[model samples]
Target: MAKNTGKAYEEFVRTIQQSLITAEGMSHLKNIEVETNKKLTDRNGIERQFDVYWEFDLGGYVYKTVIECKDYASSITVEKIDAFIGKTADIPGLRLIYATKTGYQSGASIKAEQHKIDLLIVREADEREWTAEDGTPLIKTIQLNIVALTSPRITSFAPNVDTDWLEKQKDLNADIINHAFTSSLNNEIFISNESTGHKFSLFDLSHLLLKKIPDIQYGKGTFSEELDNSYLETKAGDIKIKIKGYKLDYEYHAPITTSSVIDYSKDLLGIVEKYNTGTKQMIFKDGKIK
Candidate 1:
């Protein structure tokens, strides 16, 4: 459990860092490389491990950053910050950033700021975090309407054949009425409207019927689309057929309405850390929201 928890935290940090480097978010950054559990040798030739390490190239120069994460239940102390400072001293040219689950102790902030290290409290956002300057909490509620559609069942299919056109063509079989323009249950044949020249397949017709299902509040319903001047292509030749229509029966249950207010602490994929004066981002546990 502890190993899984640590890995989860590392990924959470790496994922949010990716979001930050995007053009829509941070500026003066591009072509970033981020990783977790990166180990690098210090000036003393001793290897040091970083919870999260990232670098970016901008204007022909590369900026290296190392982030240390502490998933403690309690606030971080100044002693921890001191240890982090010493840990990074030998690893020169590194921008230092530290993150924790809770927050920093009273003097920890001053100490970290003095050393030019940024401190962040990364965790789930709470309702109290969303508030106006006057302390009035903003409500995060949404109303969703889910309309349910039943499987469409085709009741009957009738294809009208153009016998006049068939009579003109001598090579076509005269008994085309029975074999031609027939509906294939698997939608294997393509047909078109003789007058409008609109092509349709059995699958397309099914989709059309699904789209045409009437918006009814409740109960079962029967519907159909009138199709005319339709023709089917056959092995003998193109057979002009007029389709009366496709009749279908379907049921539409009443829409289900749900009203919900977002609880960031419990409902989201992960937590977010808002800096005092920087880009705001959410760090998901799985490293992504979508």
Candidate 2:
């Protein structure tokens, strides 16, 4: 017999709630509320508990969205969608969302479409490494895909405003590079121009260069001085970078790939060299870093 776990479905609900809360457009909404297993009274004086509830203020109006999570081995049936629709009718201006781990039946999809309910199929990413028949090791990684069966029809009630985060996607590559550099070095890197000096992290330099020259492509490889040499190249110019290991006190030795070469590289070498004391050594002990 299979073991009975009371909280077996709690993690699934939490992951869905978190994904919605952190989504590109959803996070910036004001007065956002996300809850799970919330009990409330309906219009007909009937009490009901929701699996997940989300509400937010947009354009001076509060919008409510309720989610029902089903973690079953079989697909959700039309009967379940009909029951959900009946409950949604009691709550005014409530958007009903149904999420299932095993997807929905064909009739269930039709029912959701008729009621304008949003259906989401949530699946966790599967990652594994195995040897093939030829003795070659292979790896596979699959990401979670939150597919919407029907689009929410409640947008007409609120103004169609584009999120600032979505607008930044055009410059996403540059933004990612900047964020990585600045965050990695804690905003200590600096760059000087013809007249003025500006400070940026490794990511900042990359972003700035990319912006100045649109054709440049940023690439990275495994840290190796002899075999692998990583560099940033553009139509204007190219710079060679070395992957040097810097040993911090009692910490893991971080690889500093870029040195002071141009306007961005000044003072970076000194800062990185300060941590390269070579006193702290990493010894492989029992297949672990020590």
Candidate 3:
């Protein structure tokens, strides 16, 4: 798994390099090399190869841009960034760029600015600015819809936030699920759109929905036949969807892993009865509104 992952990472890094140097011709950069295998000895005598390198003419001065791409489950810390910067100090006129899948942690931007280095942080999908329910403006990183049992495909757009690791994970999960699903189903997919709305076989929807909402439970019997007679049941935190023409249209809502504000309000009385008079068992915080 690690080998395959490394191969994919190398490929992705190369693709980006090609896009910048060959396709985009970014500035005065030339001869972008991906994993040229030019090994350097770290300050601790540990050897590491540069992930990418290119020559750029900055104000008629030829400078080398050395990049280190990191894909890790955790965010890059100041120590790691410092190490990468230290790794290139031996080479003269070295401009450093660090690209990470998980992004850098706090103080990274300050360190980069202090060192006059370019830091590129990439994540799965960029964030978008949106107003909250209370009209508070904020930005949220877009979460990709990764079907657990389907192959993931990424549609790229200019990211509002870094999402390198998220994107990688989504793509990897998608690839595995898609291959299995395609193989299991023999790749025979059909689509239909009628005036009554789109219609798909219960078998297909069942599989798709199962991947999408694995926690949801469907009642006994097939869904294709139950669509026409069912009405949705949304009480008890259960979503009972009844499709008029297909029995398979009855997909129970996914389990509630998290509760909403309304859920607490609706069940407040029950909670109060269950825990309010508990003889100091339920301790409220200083600022809490009991």
Candidate 4:
């Protein structure tokens, strides 16, 4: 497939863009107009322009989406992403999209795992041709859209009492065990011993810890358990685990891949390092670090 130069990709993106325009009109877009070098003022009162911006009208509301086209069949940089988001942040109801001739970056999938933001790669594939029994070309246009779109929602962490309490230990990095532990012992409790005290205010801790775990369960094996928010992210590593609450009143566990192929160990450490010392030791083995 790589030898073919990814013709399948180019076809997909072209089709997707066309479909988006034809099916969904932009603000003031009577007909699908692909505009390049489109400029818009930013919140800082600075004028900024995009490589490609789509404007259409939808349901009496004008809508605009910003798109950046890339050639390298890889992912984008965080720095580049920060700039893009910054540009459109002020545009009310504005959607951001990316177009690339190559595939996505390794990090792109991670960012896109939820509401599928932060990654958009366009790879072209070879056009398929079909012939009749007589070997004559079939009269057909196969314009398919293969791009995926995610909702525009922020992924929150699952509630962890220990993580929440350890987050308060402060001034040092802490490692949060990916497991879910909920006890009716107390709505707000502190589980740490003297010299290192950890406080878990059910409300504050739940909300805070939930930002990292993304999924959690509260209750016993026999009773109705309360689940928390959902996280839309790709597993980057195995060392990190996530639990989240979902709509159907269920608690789900998301295990970060432990396989060596994934590089999430560092990322998880970075995330957990912002917490307490007591929790930090639990994550690091023999001070050699994972």
Predicted structure 3: clash tally: 25
Over 1-290, each residue of candidate 1 has an lDDT whose tens digit, in order, gives 34546677777777666655552444456556678999989999999999999887778977889988887888889999999999999988899999877888868888998999988766656664467669887655554555554444444454444567566776667466556645344365556767877876655555565456545334556665666666665434465443455554544454455555544444444455544454445444434442
User: How close is each model in CA RMSD to the real structure?
Assistant: 8.6, 28.7, 26.9, 29.3
Task: Report the C-alpha displacement of residue 64, candidate 2, in angstroms.
Answer: 0.7
TM-score of each: 0.53, 0.42, 0.36, 0.34
lDDT per residue (tens digit) for residues 1-290 in model 3: 34434445544554455444543445435444545345766566777577766665657887666667676777778888788767776665677777665556767766776787766643232221134457786543333443333321211111111134335443345455345334432123222333455544324454555565445553422222223333322222122223233222343433334322322222111101111122211111221222
Instruction: Using TM-score, rank the candidates from best to worst.
Output: 1, 2, 3, 4
lDDT of 1: 0.66
Instruction: Kindly list the per-residue Cα lDDT of model 2 for residues 1-290, writing each as its tens digit.
Output: 98634244645555445544554356777646677787768889988888888788888888887877777788889999988988778888888878765667889888888887877755442211134557775443333444332211111111111244335546435455445343433234322221233223333433343344344322321111111222222222221122221111111122334333222212111110001121221112121211
Name the weakest run of 10 consecutive residues (lDDT summed) in model 3: 267-276
Positional deviation of 155 in candidate 3, in angstroms? 50
> Residue 174 lDDT in model 3?
42
**Model 3: how far residue 273 lies from native, Å:** 50
lDDT of 4 by residue, 40-143 (tens): 88767888877666666757997776666555544465555555666666756767776554444445534434323434443322212234457787543433
Local distance difference test, each candidate? 0.66, 0.48, 0.45, 0.41
As a TM-score, model 2 comes out at 0.42
Clashing pairs counted in every model? 2, 3, 25, 40
Ranking by lDDT: 1, 2, 3, 4
In angstroms, how far off is 32's CA in candidate 3?
4.7
After superposition of all CA atoms, the RMSD between model 2 and the true structure is: 28.7
Highest-lDDT candidate: 1
